[model samples]
Target chain A: MSAPGGVLVIAQAEGGALSELSREMLALARRLADETGGMVEAVLLGENLGDSAGDLIAFGADRIHIGDGAAYTAYLAEAWMPKLIEVAADAPPAVILIGHDTMGADLAPRLAIRLGTTVATACVEAEFVAGRLHATRSCYGGAARETLSFKTGPCVLTIKSKSQAALDRNNGRKGEIVPLAADAVQTRVRIVERNVSAAAGVRLETAAVVVAGGRGLNGPEGFKVARELADLLGGALGASRVACDLEWCPASIQIGLSGRTVAPELYLALGISGASQHMAGCGGAKTIVAINNDPTAQIFKSSRFGIVGDCQEILPPLIDALRVLRDAKDS
Target chain B: MHIAVCVKQIQDPEMPTALLRVDADTNKMMLTSSVSPVISPFDEQAVEAALRIRDALGEARITVLTLGAEPARQVLKAALSLGADEGVLLSDPAFQDPDSYTTALALSAAIGKLGDVDLVLTGRQAADFDAGVVGCGIAELLDIPAITFARDISVDGGTIRVQRVIENGHEIVEVASPALVTISHEIGAPRKASLRETMRAARKPIAVWSVEDLALEAAQTGALGARRVLEALYIPSRDIECEFQQGASAREMAQNLARRLYQANIL
Candidate 1:
């Protein structure tokens, strides 16, 4: 069979709205499809995720593949990989785009291994040149960027979150949904239970605003200020790896090369020194405000606006001001 | 229980490097003579996880393995200091700069050389490159079940119950023994090295194995045998310019920021 002149965007059901990264992929894929005269195809994997199909179509997907089963209710490599391989074999998309989130992080490499293709992760930008996919990624903790070209087949790339803007949806568009058989393959690993932290609010990946604390917060108690600010802003809370390492914040809230990558409209860095690892994770933020006593702190290099003062003195007043503004708007 | 942990030696990332050179022809990063190497951070987590498991199981034995230059023995020593029963170094000039796939094959061969191993443990990803592919690649090569980004793991009735970190949450997975697990830093905080343990590790013999000893062909590993090639490397230029917001009072700076946010329609 001839190769499918389309891009396959893997979507998750739980992370609804096609996710910012998937939307960004669609935007990039749409450009690729326009150039290649191919269609943009989306693959949605989850249990009972049919509700999300319409959004994918609106975002420029010409065809959608839905693989729904209890096995996919949570991510299981044993289950997800086989289904994805089947879809890829049947469709034979020239390129497969995945998010840089944890699922994409695990699935992309495994899928590339199984499909015998080359895969690139944490891609800041990607384009098709001379029929080959070239992806640019941050290396050495965002201190460097390298453009990599794949000479292999079925090029798979995971775009870093917030690297590309999500395409504006065309409201009335609809696409084809092809359902796959999930029970055909036996899974070696069985997910017996799922424990999601109830305290985790407004997932950092999807949040529009994020308030992050660092080691400058001093201790675990200092995180409350960042948390309160996030809560007031109706956003999520984040921490530098140091804060997490100090046990001041949970690992889930950590943002860095080893933690979550967030692309928020506003990122308030409270006392973060902005190490390369930490900067790489938040480079996507549209606006960064750094609060630190050290004027020479590296965080200022990446921040659009910086405050040279202790977060302890700066945060409470900012939080109060935001609270006033919010209350004024509410009233 | 027999647990095999894979470790790697890498240049300390947090250290300030004055200069680094890449061979124009070979595309290899050359560290300055002043540069010092330490155990890869993720590998430290792997060692800690193995040690914890050994302590919990009581009868378990932990063996640490690595492949690199002679100085790579430092990683094995660190592992030994952390309470590993033995250390094995697969040091050979040819193993340098192997792609993830080739490295996986070589490690799999080394594991095969080690005889009956019940569980293979490795860090989710090495600090260098951060490809996060080796453990999974090894599992693929061995055709064994592998779990990546394991935050918590327990041995229950001969089955490995692992908590795998997903995008927004975690899932509890149960797989039979002889499976491979790649642990994340979330597994647990690493233990501190003590003076006594450091002295003990100095005397702990590290068995060295080469490609010839493992019966692996030189053509099977390293850059020549690798599937992927780094076409180019360059430093990323920072676009945002830093302007020091110096003011007499913290409130004054906040006022300026609030005005800027308002001007930017962000307030």
Candidate 2:
């Protein structure tokens, strides 16, 4: 086998467009490849990758490998892994990057085992030094960060969402497009049902502004105020792990170490003490505004602005004030 | 039916950040008395998942396996108290501080030693290291299929059905027997051990296995076998100075905060 050199990103598509995380991986791959002196390549796998190959090149991919078929749309490690190995046979990549989403959490480790290697999972930072990958990941429920380096090359990594910036599209750049057949592999796993419980308003993972509530809300009714605030701001509603555990909110919207990770431009944390675990999910927000009655809460330390008061008392007036501002801007 | 559930005992993840102390020299958290050890929350849920299956079947044997130090037996005992039929403690000096790869190797070896395990279950990830790889690694080593991030699970004849959590929603997946499933926090809280069961668990004899017992090489079972090298571990220091929104009353403070956000262009 040839020695691994370039970086490979496994691109994912949602609603017929390249997923935000797929683009983020391309951005990171570009930076890493530029620094390490290797080509930036991507593998697009789906039923109909239509124009995604061109998009991949525009996003800094030097080459795009397409695996188009019905089997590629829904990810089952059994079917996708062999296809990936077959695609990489032409030019093996030193590092394979996947977004640390549901598919990644299932695929990376198994793929590493198949390749007789190891994976650095959910990495927030990574760089190539001395021909090896050094990755930094959070552990101890996000209370601490651990930096690790692989002993050998040809490793896999699942990058945390929103951890890196996507480069601006440059249509003028040129790249190669290679198509590969979807090999037949017997897969034991079958997706019997796919449920998309549609929620109103913006999606939490990509929302620019996020409004999160915690146990300090006193009861489930508190979420009514939070939902109204989120809808008024055209944002999304989120909850801490405790609130979800207490059944005050659906677990689908929980934001914490064990839950969803959201990186918004502005994060308003209401009635939350900001445990390290909870902060892990939203620490990437550009601006954090915290409101808790406890002046010394941990959230205050991470917040750019804090208000020490009861959320119940502050939220109503805050909503009114936001309404006034929105009306003024509209006029 | 024979089921094997893997569990781990670690410092309570819910402990306050002030109590979390890291030893720079060792690259490990300082295990102070203030922070008590408990079963990793998700692993406890895994145990619950196994018990739920056993309850539905009316006749099934569940075995709890844990690879850690002697004290790690507490997690096994906790599982036994929750109605696991047996407990196996995989412990050895060589097993100390193993990475995810070595840990998976040792656990899979132990499972092989069990001779007949129709199904395997584990938490999505341990709260401490959060590597989230052992379950899949075990599946690979055993040459079986794995469905991860399972929020719900049920069995029919020789097939296992799992409701897996995806990005926007959930997907129901089905695989044949001898497969593995990693339980997520969405599985709901685990049941508490009763006082009588706890007493019984205290008296239950747990089988202990060493590296040699599992036929694993000393060089391939612990830190010596770890494929990943830890360069550093530390808490990220935060120095953001928070400016408090001030006003004469709650309503006024809300208004001022709104105006401040607008001025800062954050709204």
Candidate 3:
């Protein structure tokens, strides 16, 4: 029952390889493809994506569209957009999904404009309602959820990270790779240099656990305890928007409306008051554990477990005890 | 060179989540009167980016532009108070509730009507819809090159250098005039409009143009031009009943919680 046009998940390569979100997009695309009785297709736009098609196929893509070029090594919207549009126009899938991260934010709208279509950004979920494909996206800074249905086919979408669990890779899975040439174009915007300040440790989006600190931590010094706990748990350390704005931590690790959205298995919020904007980002956590001195903090309402205590005092013993538990496991 | 900055006024994004109401019948989130509207924070950043160019250029004209009803003029004046020279408001009943595509259509039309716009600026995304599309949409419509998510920007002669904020580090992009740049929160903290400037802004006339003035048909723009429609909007309910841990001391509490977490295999 395969349809003429399948689902296309635009895969982005960061530092010359496919990003983690691409896997998640494939996961969601596979789900939607199953629901629509269509094939799941993926397109990789990069410089040298070696054997990426095999991995993409193993993950869920039935076919791969590879757009390779030196210009695509680093993302230049003008350089890569035309190629993507060409691919989309050729396959003209029923739906096209892109990650809502930096690349997608820059590329999706332009593609929509070029294709004479519209796009939905920061979508957390997707579904079919009344026999039409609908994307559920966060609105009003995550205070409200809105479902939108595209008026035209091959709807362009930018998928938010951490919205779906990535599928397990199966190298045995079968898929076909079709290479496409994306011509480079001269444009007003020229990227002279790219200096990436890589985030400290584990990737927040893929981490099973996250330890985030907020302004209530008082100062940057307080993040030390949060960091220790994060390290002990083998997870990523995060900060709320205010803490990031206050320069207590890097902006990249901020967990809030404008920052990265994470839905880790266990989200431990330390000294964070849980503003709606911050909650909007981490609302997907399987278990939210809040540790703050203020018992009345809003985070307590959403947390599955709450501890009314100072993070500075509680975290040290907690970390030590967790270390002891690890020691026991090793013994 | 004259630069136009697109700004929007949205129901306060910082409003507590519980107070935000959703009307099931209309499938819309109602903007309650309790929380007054404010300029989307990033749009304020966009105004700041324009003001910076104006500062460096000695006496460049900065025009603040917006597409909405009358109340939008207030936010436009807020930009004017930040050292903009003029304000252009695109007001029409047809402009209400348009998605970013239609919104961009109207704004680009207004920008085109303004004529000789050397540069354009917009917030990375509107705080309400949280769709960061209008800036690029306008660039596409106007056929101008766009640099998005700029953390820092500086203009030299006809070329502008923007330290674009990407996921990892940053990229130093150089784009020529007749371009557009989208401002993110990373674009330095926006300065508040001073009282003297705010009072002076009250006297400055803000020009209001409708769809007719922009040579745009009402039916072909705004809601009609919107490429997508909101079918339903609601709050996802949280059903978790938190388990509050209590103990004689912090150490005991930590110990008990660790034991329970370990027992549950979360550890």
Candidate 4:
């Protein structure tokens, strides 16, 4: 853990390709490395990662450690932890960057414990301050931001998704690709089944516009108005934690502190009270429009425009008007 | 079977953002009297998950544990009222303002002191800090398997099965005893405590433990044991001026709003 080394990015492959967050991590690592005069390295562990290794280099990785096998396909921390440690041993990293997703949250702290290094999770901003890693993360359910620095080196970090900008692909970039030392390790935990819930349209994270429903909608059926608005806008539909907790919407689309964080161009909040936890997810939107009957609702505080009326009373006409505007623009 | 569920009490996360203020001196949120404290919502769900395990086994011991100030005992009482068998509060002057690492260190020591915990349950992330690392840290310190974001959990014989929520969907994972599983919101709402249980909880004796009780050194319990240092803490300011559209009717208002969005080039 004390060896002089560069930043290490752990790349996660989704659907046989490098995930967006992985690329973002590489970009952030590149920035940190450039500032500190260190090389940028990444570990890509999965089957058929030949192309992704190149993508990782193109995204700013100076070296790619490949663990290409079926055993690396599933995200079993017990299996991958040993491999990550092996990589770190070969080239001890000053900073280890991971995507602050499910896999990262599951692995970072454990890796820190094993490596005897400090770790930070869900960090939005990370920089090298006086040769130490300083990371800023949203806390207090996103009501405040806290900046923390490690007391020592080799800090493990889980970077929040969509916080860092990914560098443009540069096919001309060259990096080293080496095979990791293979080992057979026994894992006590097993993933028996994986069920992929069918997503309807544009993904919530990448959607340009998002229409979200909340408790003000009252029940499951009220989401139809939200769906119609999203459809008209050609965007994605989202929900508050309450909506998802009540089973009115899938938890996958819950936008809140414990759920997905979205930064769409336009966020249309329907009947949402804009609790701090919920705002933690959608606060990054360029523009937020809220429709809640309660004038004192918290959502209005963060919104650019607000309509203080019952969503049920105003939504149908609003949808109709938006549809008409769309049709007019189309014709 | 023995189950330990770790919970935390914090200023209600659902409190209005306007009330949130940072104490520059301490680099922490100013706990205002205007905001009443509540058990972290996800930790409540963790208590619920433990109760379900007890119900499934029909004869299992569930102990609710919390590491905070004395006020944290309130959360333990709430859990006890909801049917947990025992309550343990790790409270001491030396335990104040520990980072995630130290927090986990102290909690793991307490778990070891508990002596025979077969399984551990905790919220996916505390509603306040949202660190989501203590459960795994405890597992790491105890050298046990940890499964996170568990939506559903059940016990069968000596193994524990969990439906872990992932980015796309869920993955059903199984592990043997001596494991830690972090509960998620998909576990559904926790059951309410009955009036009789509430009264009974009022009389229940809570076991309070200190750093010495867990055999943890003061240096390894709080700020001294902290792995990371907080440099700054402050609320991010937002200044979006909201414009309300005026109209003779709801439809007119909707029309005006749409046109305004287009004019602003946001649509």
Q: What is the C-alpha local distance difference test score of each model?
A: 0.80, 0.89, 0.86, 0.88
Question: What's the residue-level lDDT of B126 in candidate 3?
Answer: 89
> What's the i-RMS of each model?
2.3, 1.3, 1.3, 1.2
- Give the chain B TM-score for each candidate: 0.92, 0.97, 0.96, 0.96
TM-score of chain A of 2: 0.94
The alpha-carbon lDDT assigned to residue B61 of candidate 2 equals 87
- DockQ, candidate 2, comes to 0.78
**Model 3 chain B: ten consecutive residues of lowest lDDT:** B236-245
Q: What TM-score against the true fold does each predicted structure earn?
A: 0.91, 0.96, 0.96, 0.96
Error of 2 at B1 (Å): 1.0
TM-score of every candidate's chain A: 0.91, 0.94, 0.93, 0.96
Q: On residues B116-154, what C-alpha lDDT tens digit does candidate 3 reach at each position?
A: 988899999988888999999999999999999999988
Tens-digit lDDT track for model 2 on A182-246?
76678999889998778667899999999999977878999999999999988999999889989
* Model 2 interface RMSD over true interface Cα atoms: 1.3
Tens digit of lDDT per residue, candidate 1, span A171-197? 788789887775645877777888787
What digit string (tens of lDDT, one per residue) describes model 4 on residues B1-267? Answer: 999999999889877777888878888788889778998889999999998888888999988899998888889998999988899999999998898888899899999999999999999998888898898999999999999999999999999999999987999999999899999888888999999889888877789999999998898878888889999998888757789877888788888888888888897
Lowest lDDT 10-residue stretch of candidate 2 chain A: A1-10
Candidate 4 C-alpha lDDT tens digits along A1-331: 1224799999988666788899989989988888777789999787766588888889999999988887887788999999899888878888999998888999988999888766889999998777667899999888889899987668889998889889999999999988875555799998899998878889998899999999999888889878988988999999998898788988899998888888899999999999888988999898999989898888888999988888887889998887887788889
For lDDT, candidate 3 versus 4, the one ahead is 4
Error of 1 at A196 (Å): 1.5
